[model samples]
Target chain A: MTGVLLPLLSFFFAASIVSLGWADMLIIVIYFLLVLGIGYYLMHFTKTGDDFFLAGRKMTMWIAGLAFISANLGSLELMGWAASAYQYGILATHWYWIGAIPAMLFLGIIMMPFYYISKTHSVPGYLKLRYGESSRMLAAISFALMTVLMSGVNMFAMALVMKVVIGWDINVSIWVSSITVMVYVVLGGLLSAIFNEVLQFMLIWFGALLVPIIGLVEVGGWSGMVAKIHQNFPAGDYTHLWSTLGHFKDNPMGIQWIGIVFGLGFVVSFGYWTTDFLVVQRVLSAKDLRSAKMAPIIGSAFKMMVPFIVILPGLLGLAVMPGLVGQNQAAMTGAQSYNEILPLMMARYLGPGLLGLGVTALIAGFMSGMAGNVTAFSTVWTYDIYKPLHLAATKREVADAHYVKVGRWATFIGVVISIGTAYLVQSAASIMDYVQALFSFFIAPLFGTVILGMLWKRATASGGFWGLLAGTASSIGMWIWVRIDPSALRIIAGSPDAKAMAEDMYRGLWSWVICVVVTIIVSYSTQPKAEAELVGLVRGCTDLPSEGHLPLVKRPIFWAGLILVAFIILQIIFW
Target chain B: MADEKLKSDSRATDSPERISIWFFIGAVLLVYGIIILIASIPGVSSPEGAQHVMLADLHAGIWWGALLIVLGAVYVAIFRPGRKKD
Candidate 1:
């Protein structure tokens, strides 16, 4: 704790003085200090990389679930996601009720069995155990590539919003957002992330849950906006929801409904909930297997409700923004940075004092998310990579002491690299689109390896390794193929790419198929590595008799049950 | 019935741990209810643009209704039918 206590004091001293005269800043400061203080205190708990990563595998299920949900829900989930509403409309978040909710519930019942059964930290660790060293290495590389790299997106988005609100320079906001996040995270590791998550979660919910009813009154209530909506966008064209809920009706996003659901919900959610390192680190830090599985499951269930707070605000925002409202239909549609839309509304509407509070809320969200990521980055490096090569300590011995100094250095180094890379990537344009697209690059590719590695004994590491490369390349290739040579894809896909609608439908489907095919082919060709004591580990996991080591259920009842439940939920959401 | 006795010293692996459904529901609902009621104090909705309604917080009375429904579903799902001991 002394090791943690010293650095955090200096960090807090610096952050407290960064901004001026914000009463809310003081409130946010209290939160910052408490989290930092507790995080520093808990450094006593982190003995090894495992403790740092999984809270020494001692977190209860409730804390694990809340922390997991809160970490995911940060500014990205709240402000940025709701701002998606501000930019587009409720249709953006309609995915929650339809796509996200079903995905989360299904994740708990289906994926939990595999994850808890593995008893590993991070998805890559699971691969290493089931597939082999080769697969583990690939999974790690892809995890770093997808999860770590895409994190720059959220950081960049938070910084951009700060620029809009306080008129702070983007680069300055970037630095402030990055440094503040690393401050507590480097001090405490996952404990800091978890503790801070408790506070940050409350702030986001308060912020998200606040905007709509207030906005509704400002916008002339639902009735006033109802008139304005009809005057501008024409009947039923403004929202897919108005015409037919959850089904697209001439919306510009043009994403096919099926693609949106499966690609975003199943593949993307699976990757994030089951595989993505940042999210996984949250689950990994859980006290035990039940907490790990239930964290995401419950987290997803919590997340499913977020649309009420975020997405609905966008529809409400339309009534207020001069850009979206006018005397006539043609006037409402025009060019603007939708990213600026939310902050602009806040600054214009909330008055400077309250506006400062909103900025502080975003900063809190930004810090919480950044801290979670830094914790994940540090955990993987120390546990998965460092301890394995350098230390000869026994597992129990490894599990019982403090490594704060090493952990802090890991965080500092990760932050520097991330900040440097984010600056380079800033030129790409549209912070939300760029980051999301980049996220898709890694998450889509690794989804196959994560699932196969868990479910099959034959999923050798060499296969896992090859499968990851193939999946990543295949996904990237699909992206490029769609953009550059849609014509070339027509032959392979047996659909004409010249048609925009065809291109849209094919892109999501092809990405999924390509990744899956490559993983299976590569996995099948590789010689299966005889894992050391495979049956023993599996038996120990299910706690079944030693002979069969078979799964607890005779058939795929759990997965089937989940799919049925998902179908039922989807029916209600769509019906 | 056999599964009932096989308890461990782990929150993650043990049988369903009871969560405070009331506290969770009450906190979110109470805050929202108070806020909406206060706003309807007939003065919080200041006319800024086309017309404006300001909420010091996000929660409102309706949010209580929504949360109760969701929380109820969550409670029903997590708590299984049977109880057991270590």
Candidate 2:
């Protein structure tokens, strides 16, 4: 262990020695100032809760699409996936493709119209419209709490990156990021967050593009990377996507393709990409129903390419970086302790100016993620929680500006709470474990409930409430059972892997099954609202607006179809 | 009662004049240009006196900066505000 520690320490020391120059610092400062300026400039536009929370529903398809993906392009999506790529190899691309693409496209085609036509400010608001107060309150409170915790996770991740890369004190890193995020979010609300996210999206691509480009250049090209990876790690099948993924024992992921297909691709990915309010809020802010429908489709196109930016870096780390793939590193830190793969690559490949831009991209990713969470949290808290409670007590209608004021306060309070949560997460041995657990508890179950309510007119409000409760409870129970008796997971999850991610995927699948079953059983027993009452809320009952006289090629369906084709082509090529 | 409140609250706000997508694209180019240009300047150093290297040998910051500036100029010119009036 000490042998591993010594080398790891030496590696970190060597990487940290490459400090930022004056130009780098200047560029970072300019980036921050520009972000703040955007917030201040947009403040005039944010007059009411409508504008504050949903950008006055005036976002174009391009803005909505970029922001949709950008909101998810946080520290975790960047660093965690890169780390996964390094650890799990090309199999990590599944999270972007089979895991995300289908769900996002489904959302654009099947779900966005209801959300747009219903005109709800948040996901919880949608629930209240379709179900009742019970379901809405449960979802709102849980979602609000989860967003803050997720934001803290981003904060902790950014601080960890700074400590590893530049050797900054974690506390200073946390404070600087928290303050910067709080300023923009509080000043301009969702619009500011989305605008900055669009900018960060561009920066992430430009900055991280160098790694794969330069790394591929160094290794010759695509074929060269595969050959080098094969030579370096003879025991690992790093290149094959679906062919070698037949059984748990067949691949490094240590799970069957069925589990990957059903658990991650169907349950967890659909849960997150389709229902998670963080990305949904971006689409909900679109100028028109058409733009809202187009947003996720456009986002799916970009999301498909994300593996190159995130996963490719990890593959490069394995092929290039020495002492990263040995038994000691894997034993001490699962997956070769390649969490710092991204920063290490940046330190090595980027000269001076580009280096600053790369680091700024990291910062931008962290802040954008933090901002996404806080803005989403504030919207939910103010609209779904505080305002509803206030109305219940006062029995009066408050002005839209009153809600806007509450949103600002919520943003401030949310950031402070997130800062506290970030410190709390410091005690955890693994941040990824905690986050994945949170997702299983909240996201998967919520997806089950939302999908049922959206698709079926017969689903009762009481059913939605009880179904959500049962799903969450089952997920927790399964997690505890797995913890106490490691063997128990094998019954449901098929063969268990040593990796937590595989377990998480299986847990999500089981929880979703429980939720759906309970919802159906309870719904049949209870009285459902009449079809007349459920008109716009349920599919088949509602008449979806026609795609405005636009040509076939210009319509969202055409683009979505093209994306689906591209997805299949890539899968086949990678396979 | 709740439905009524939702209806009242969700009234569509007036549609503002369309802001051309080019504006955002131009703004991004301008920011990237400035950063690249500043970083490409010579004699920039760390506090420890380590010199910074240029990103590329072809005066990358200068050329990219100039090109982006021109592109931004063209975009802003073509899609300038109040073009609908014309």
Best by TM-score: 2
Could you tell me the TM-score of chain A in candidate 2? Answer: 0.95
Against the true structure, whose lDDT is highest?
Answer: 2
- Give the alpha carbon lDDT tens digit for every residue of A1-575 in model 1: 33554344334333211232233234344545555565666555555666566666666555566677776666766665655665555557655655455555555555655556667766667666666666666556555544455557667666655554554566776786677667767666776677667556755665444555467766677678756665655634444442342333345444445545665556665565656677666766666454555566656656666676666566666665635432134335544445545555554434222333455557767777777777777766665666555564554435334445667787888788777667756876555454555566666557676666555656666666666677667666776776686576564345342234334334444555676777677768877656554542332224422323536442333433554576456456533
Residue range A1-575, candidate 2, lDDT tens digits: 43454444334333463476555665566778878887887777788888899987877777789899999998667888888788888999999999999999999999999888988888889899999998999999989988898788778867877876777678888997798889988888898898889888877887778778778877878888888888888998988889878777778888778778999899999999888899999999998888899999989999999999999998887788745643356566665357778887777666556677788888888888888899999999998999889999999998888999999999999999888878878887476466647755978889999999999998999899999999999999988898898888677677655355578888899899999999999999999998887777789789998887889976999989999999999989998
Chain B superposition TM-score per model: 0.30, 0.55
- Give one clash count per candidate, in the order shown: 15, 0
Off by over 4 Å in 2: A1-17, A325-336, A427-432, A496-498, B1-25, B34-86
Candidate 2 chain A least-lDDT 10 residues: A5-14
Candidates' C-alpha lDDT: 0.56, 0.80
Candidate with the greatest DockQ versus the true structure: 2
Model 2 residue A145 distance off true place after TM-score fit, in angstroms: 0.7
